[model samples]
Target chain A: GAGVSQSPSNKVTEKGKDVELRCDPISGHTALYWYRQRLGQGLEFLIYFQGNSAPDKSGLPSDRFSAERTGESVSTLTIQRTQQEDSAVYLCASSSSMNTGELFFGEGSRLTVL
Target chain B: AQSVTQLDSQVPVFEEAPVELRCNYSSSVSVYLFWYVQYPNQGLQLLLKYLSGSTLVKGINGFEAEFNKSQTSFHLRKPSVHISDTAEYFCAVMLTGGGNKLTFGTGTQLKVEL
Candidate 1:
């Protein structure tokens, strides 16, 4: 794709249900990132991946929240036992490399856990 | 650890008037600065970035920002704002070589009105 792409632009689920958000980074980009944005709030870093380096899980809020990226391609963020507080927009971004400061972003997936 | 701060939650400016959105960051090591804009129902796009060269950086839509190391601030400015300029602006910081994790601020809502 010309830019980062995300699936399930909007998702609505009941509390305690599980949800998965997908992100497909720009082709050939070696770095990918996931972030969460609450209503009217700033973005919160969730995870990051660069090449073959160990994925950064430091930003994951809890064990219920886990993400996996296959090589330099598609990535999935799964929220298990979702809570109402999990309601927010999940954004995905990709950069050419870890050294590059500019990031291309996806439209984002909005999750509403009721 | 690095963090960003956006003091103004919202800034209302009249059309064609000048506007400024303040951003501050704290980091133990050298860092890169960036500004991103999010339009309604859209994804975030990079406005500008400061790496190593000049302190003044110009971005799209006639927007610019200055990186002030002394004050740890990267303030976004526009000489004249249009109604289309109304959007949410975010400031972010990335570690030069630490882990490539980008930390973002709460964001500033710029409301350009008539």
Candidate 2:
């Protein structure tokens, strides 16, 4: 079976630029999540979408970070006016349903802000 | 808000030796516990999860974890580790309700030496 997939395995951009990271969740998955992992740090929740509705967006560090999922399928995490602090790996995950307790993750998109 | 703690920032063990990574979580409600492994240049992989039924759960790559309710701990253990096990480990907890958002702890780097 195909697992989650992400685009642009690596991206190098200058500060103040905007970047978009894409994620393709597994087929029939109704739940999608976005997370960020700073260098030598842990995974931090960014946003979550369930069937096109974002029920939790509190984990998004700032307004500069935004994510959207359409029809419980592909998802995109966009960082506006990116800063050096936003240099990290953006991760995407999906589960079959709510409370499944297991999320399949995709190879993260590594963003380097200079 | 729920929080997870990885007591060890790094753990170094000789190949073929036993290893344990400690994890503790604090949450107001019952939650799902998970352990994920991230190899260099790869996505996070689900090691094991403790949702319900049994306190002990086994996962891929000879990994296992035990969920403790009273102590609020879910520690991962492997009797023998290979150099291939060298990677970063993260402990996470997701609330039973409230949209299945994950709260992750600072990662622990496991170095398996030959």
Candidate 3:
């Protein structure tokens, strides 16, 4: 793809339900990241993937938040037992390499947990 | 550890006037600084970044920012503003030799009026 792309631009799910958000980064990019932005809050780091290495999962807020990436391509973020506080925009970004390079962002997936 | 702070939550300015958005960061190691802009219902777009060399950096849409190492600040500034410049601006920092994760500040809403 020309830029980072996210699927299901908007989602609404009830509390206790599970939601999955997908992201497809640009081709040949070796670094991908997931972030969340709650209403009136700053962007919070979720997870990061670099090449074929184990992801940097230090930013996941809780045990309910988990993510996976296939090699250096598509990534998915899964939230289990969602709560109203989970409402936010999920953002995906990719960079040419993992050396603090310029990032290309996707439009983001807006999730509304009811 | 690295964290960014955008001091002003909202800044209003008249058209054609100059504007500045303040940002500061705290980090134990070297870091990279960046500014991103977000229009309504859209994702973030990279405005500029400071990696190495000169402190002054120019970005898209005639925007510029200066990185002050001593104060740990990277403030975005524009000599003159326009109505189209109204958007949410964010300051982000990435550890120079760390993973792909980035720490972002709470955004500053820039409102340009006639």
Q: After superposition, how far is residue A79 of candidate 3 from its true place, in Å?
A: 0.6
On DockQ, who's better, 1 or 2?
Answer: 1
lDDT of 1 by residue, A1-114 (tens): 598999999999999999999999999999999999999789999999999999998989999999999999999999999999999999999988644678889999999999
**Rank order by lDDT, top first?**
1, 3, 2
Docking class of 2: medium
Residue pairs clashing, model 3: none
- State the lDDT of candidate 3 residue by residue for B41-114, as single tens digits: 77798899999999999999999999999999999999999999999999999888856577999999999999
Kindly report which residue stretches of model 1 are placed more than 4 angstroms away from their true locations once superposed. Answer: none
Which lDDT tens digits does candidate 2 get at residues A1-114?
599999989999999999999999999989888889898788888888887564588888999988877787888899999999999998999987744667889999999999
Candidate 1 chain B: 10-residue stretch with minimal lDDT: B95-104
Tens-place lDDT digits, model 2, residues B1-114: 799999899999999999999999999988999998989877788888988999999999999999999999999999999999999999999888756777899999999999
Fraction of native contacts (fnat) of each candidate: 0.75, 0.80, 0.75
lDDT of each: 0.93, 0.90, 0.92
After superposition on all C-alphas, the RMSD of every candidate to the true structure, in Å, is 1.2, 1.6, 1.3
lDDT of 3 by residue, A27-112 (tens): 99998999999999999988988888888898899999999999989999999999999999999999976446577889999999
How close is chain B to the truth by TM-score, in each candidate?
A: 0.98, 0.98, 0.98
Top lDDT hit: 1
